[model samples]
Target: MSSSALPKPQMRDLLANCLRFHIVGAIIVSLEVAASYEFGVAEPRKKAYADSTKTMIPHKDFEERRKPGVFQSTK
Candidate 1:
């Protein structure tokens, strides 16, 4: 069968899935940050710098910008 025979996907569903993954990733990152903070592994200066440089994008904006069709950072 040709590729065109496959069913087309909905953008809303794709965005929802991407949002779910992003949320899960953010949770994991937050946990790591918390763990480092608790263990004192991260230096105060580094932590302060990280906190200062952290982006504060809203959830709605993040969801709007993150789409499956574009390249995204998975790190």
Candidate 2:
């Protein structure tokens, strides 16, 4: 029995595999970062729309005098 008899991957093969894995991992991380940035960029537009909707509500007197009918329309 000798140390060389044991089945093991060559150092070069192991290093190559590790390098490939790291490269793939880096690409995946970059894509995730880009997607997160795009989503964050759209948030302000969404917030603006939400703010406009809130401000479109009628004032207190108009709200009080508005009809309670089901077919009411917003002008």
lDDT of 1 at 10: 79
- Residue pairs that clash (backbone atoms under 3 angstroms), model 2: none
Clashing pairs for model 1 are none
Q: Name the lDDT value of residue 36 in candidate 1.
A: 86
lDDT of candidate 2 over 1-75, digit per residue (tens): 666776775867788899899999999999998888778877778888999888875675476656555336853
Q: What overall lDDT goes with each candidate model?
A: 0.75, 0.78
Worst 10 residues of 2 by lDDT: 66-75
Candidate of highest lDDT: 2
RMSD of 2: 9.0
- My TM-score estimates for the predictions, one after another, are 0.41, 0.43
Measured on C-alpha atoms, candidate 2 has an lDDT of: 0.78
- Local error of candidate 2 at residue 30 (angstroms): 0.7
Show how many residue pairs clash in every candidate, following the order shown. Answer: 0, 0
